[model samples]
Target: MTLFEAERVEKVFPGVRALDGVNLSLEPGSVHALLGENGAGKSTLIKVITGLYRPDGGRLLLDGQQVSFGSPHESASAGIGVVHQERNLIPGFTVGENILLQQLPTSRGLVDRTAIRSEAARWLAELDLELDPDLPVTELSVAQAQLVEIAKALSIESRVLLLDEPTASITPSEAERLFRVVGKLKDQGCAVLFVSHKLEEVFEICDTVTVLRDGASVLEGGPLSDLTRDEVVDLMVGRVHEALVLPPRTVDTTAEPLLELSGLSTATGHDGVDLAVRPGEIVGLYGLVGAGRSELAKALLGLDRITAGEVRVRGAAVRIRNVRDALKNHKIGYVSENRKEEGVFLEQSVGRNIAVTVWDRLRAGIGRLPVLRYVPKRAEADLVSDYVEHLGIRIASPAQLAGTLSGGNQQKVSLAKWLAAQTEILIIDEPTVGIDVRTKDAFHTLIWDLAANGLAILLITSDLPEMITLADRVVVMRDHRVRGEVVNSRDYDTMSQRVIRLIHAEPAPAA
Candidate 1:
C-alpha cells in the first residue's frame, strides 16, 4: 500500500530551480533509496517532504489522503521524522534528554528524569549500543552520535523516516547494525527513505530506487539489477563519462618524499599503517566505511593521535602532536571528508575563511612571535582572491558568507584554503562528495593542475571513478590494513577492478 506520495513538486530559489515536477512515492514496509548527484534535487525533495520548504505547486498524500505539514514539528507529529545529514544534537544535553526533548515525562508539572533516562536507555539497548543515557551528547563519538540521532527519531514512533547520508561517517560494523535496524523498521511496517551518494550501500539495502536529475525525475524503478552502474552515471550527468588523465609516472625526481608515515596508527580508529608520497604523485587510498581511511588521514595531519608510529617529512621524522605542529613542521593541508564539520566556518565571509589559512604569509612583523597570531592585511585578501579565481569558485564576491554558496562552491572554498597554505603534501578526503557533475569536473581539473605543480597529494575517497581517474597508483584497504596496490597504466581499468575486489574481500586468518 502506498504510504506517502508527492505529485508535481516544484521549488525555486534565486538563480536555481531546485525542483521541478519531481514525483516520489513510498510504500509501507519498503526501503526506498533516492539517488542523485549533489544539487540534483535530492535534498530539496527531502526538505519539501519534511516541511522545511513549501512546494510552489504540488500535492502530498499520506495513505491516499492529502496532507499538509506546516513545520518540522507538524511533520513529526504526523509520523514523519528526519535524521539530517548534519547531526543536530545539542552538545550540552544528555542523550536521554535529547531523545525525549520537548516531550519529557512530567510529574506534578516537573520533568521526570528517571522516566526519560529509562526510556532512552531501553531504546538504545535495543540497538546494542552502550551509551550512557546521562552522558552529554558531546561525549559521544561520531558513530555513537549517529546512533543517538536514530534513537531520537525512533523515540517518536515515526511511521516514515528520512535518513540523509546516514552512513557517511559511520564505521563498517555500525553501518551493518544500521542496516539491520532499517530492516527491522521495515518489518514493523515503517517506510524508510535513504538518501546517499554511496551506491554500494544503496544496492545492499534498498528495495527500490528513484533517480532524480536536474530537479526532475529521470527514472523510477524497482530492483536495480536492470541498470548498470555506468548507466546510472550517464543518467546523472546526461553524457558518457570520460575518465580523468593522470600524468605518467617519473622515477627520477630528487624532490624527496614530502610526507611519510612509518607504521603510523591512531589508537582510536585505525591500527599501525605505513604510507609515503612523493612530489607530483597522487596516491589513492580506497576503502569502505570504517576501513580506517579518514582516521589514517587524521593521524598524518595531527588531528588524531599517532599512538605508536613516526611521521617523517623530507627524510626526517617529525613529532606532530597537534594540528599546529603538523602545519608548522610539515606544511601540510587537509580537506576533510566531513566538510560541514571541519571544512569551513560557514558564518564567516569567504575572504576571511581563505585568508585565515595564510595570514602569516601576508602579515608584517608578527604582533605575537611564538603564538603566530596576526591580523589579516591587504596582501592576504589579494592572495585569497587569487585562489578564488583559480579554483573557479562561484560566488558573487569574496565578501559573501561561506554558508550561502552552493555545496560545490563551498567545497571549492575548502580546497582553496589548503592551496593558499602552499602545502607540499595535500590530503583531501572525499573532496567531490555532495557536488554536481559540472562542478566535480572543474574540481578535478584544478586538482590535476595542483599535482602538475609538483605537489604530493593523498586523496581518500569512496568514489571509484575518481580513484581510477586521479591517482597514479591506488592503495586498497580492508579490515584496517592495506590489501592490495594497483599501478595505473594502460590497464588501469582492469587494475581498478582488482582494487575493488581487494576492498570487498574478506580478510585472511592472522598468522
Candidate 2:
C-alpha cells in the first residue's frame, strides 16, 4: 500500500494552474525521486503535499486513507516532515531551539532547554553531523544550516520525509552523509520523497521516480532501472534542457583591471589573494565548500574586516565600507549564493525586489524638494516588467510575492536586481545552485552575454562544469589561498582534471 499519495491533485493560482491532475505516490521503505524542471510545478506540489497550500481538487491519501491538512503544523502532526528548498531556520535562535521548535518540550509550563539539546543532539548524531546544539543558526554555514534543517525534520519522528533540493548548497562529501541518512530512513520504513535537479544523485539513490512537466505528471512512480538519464531529462524539459550554449567572445587583455585584489588578507583567513578582472572578462573563483571563495567576496564588500591588503577598483585603492557603498559609490554588485537570505526579499513583491537597486533613480522629487522623493508606481512596474521579460521570469504578476516563485525563478530575480543596478563589476556566487538543466543553461548564456557586453565579472562557483563553460580563466583556491590558475579551454574532461589536480596540491599549467 502507498504510504502517501497525491491522487489527481490540482492547484490553481491567479492566471496560472500550478498543478493540474498531478499524481504521485510515496511508498514505505523506498526513496522516491520527484523530477521536474524549474517552474514545472515541483515546488507547488511539495507545498500542497506539506499543506503550505491546500489543493483545489483531488485527494491526499495517507496509509490508503483519504486525509486533508490545513497547515504545515497539521501535516507534521499527521506524520509528515519536510525540508523545503528555501531555508526555514529562524535567525538568533540556537540550533537546538530551531530543531525542536514545532514540538518544544515543557516542564512546569516553561520550555525545557535540556530536553531540547539532548533531543536535537540525538537527531544530529543520527545523520553524523557534528554541529553544536547551542550554536546560533546565524553562525552556521550554508551547508551546516541545511543539515540543521534536515535534523529538525527528522526530530519530528515522522513516517514520511520530504527533502527538496537538500544538497544544492552542500558539497559532495556532505551529500554522501545525507544519502546515508536517507538509506537508514528507508531501512526504518520511512517514505522519503527526494527532489533535486542533480539527476546523477537521483539515479544513484532513488528506486522509483515521478517526473512532472508543466504542472502534470508525465511519468508517475516508475522504476528508475527502466529509464535512462536522457529519458528522464526529456520528460522533465521536453528536449530543451541539455545544451550549455555560450557565444564566443574575446576579452581585451590590454585593458586595465576593473576590480583587482592585491595581497588581500581578510579576517575570515583569506591570505595573499591576488586577482584581476578586466573589461569583458569572466574570472572564475573555483574551490571546495570551505575554501573561502564566498568569504573573499564578503571581504571585498566590507562585510568582513579587511585586516590587511588593498581592494583596488579601477586603479585606485579603496575601502568598501558596506554593500551599499560598493554598489552606489563604486558601481559594483554581488549576487550571493544564499539567495533566499541575501539575494531577494522573500516577503516583498517580485517588482519590489527587482526595482530595489534603482529605487533612487525611479523616485520623483516634489517641486524644489529633491530630498522628498517617492517612486512612481507606473515607472516601477515598467522597469520590473522589462527585467521579468528579459530574464524570462515566470510570474502571474509583478506584485506576486517572491517567496511564492520557484527556486530558479528566484535566482533569476536575484541576478536581475544586480543587472538593474547597471554595475560595471559584478560578483556572482553560485548562479544556478538549485536550478534545472535548461534554466541553468539559459543562466550561463545570460552571464556570458553580460561579460560580452564589457562588464567585469568575478564568479565564485563550486560547479566545475559551469566554471569550464563560462570562465575565461579559472583561479583555483584551496584552504583560503590561491593554489593556481588555468586558462579555460572549455574542454570538460581536461578542465575537470586540471582543477582536480590544482585542488589536490598539484601544479597547474600557466594561464
Give the winner by lDDT: 2
Candidate 2: where are CA atoms >4 Å away? 102-119, 240-242, 371-378, 504-511
Each prediction's RMSD over C-alphas, in Å, is: 5.3, 2.7
lDDT of 2 at 72: 92
Candidate 2, poorest ten consecutive residues by summed lDDT:
239-248
Measured by TM-score, the strongest candidate is: 2
Candidate 2 residue pairs that clash: none
Cα lDDT tens digits for candidate 1, 118-214: 9999779766777889999876655567788888888888899999877765645567788898899999999999987667787788888888888
Model 2 per-residue lDDT tens digits across residues 320-383? 9999999999999999999988999999999999999999988998888878789999999999
lDDT of 2: 0.91
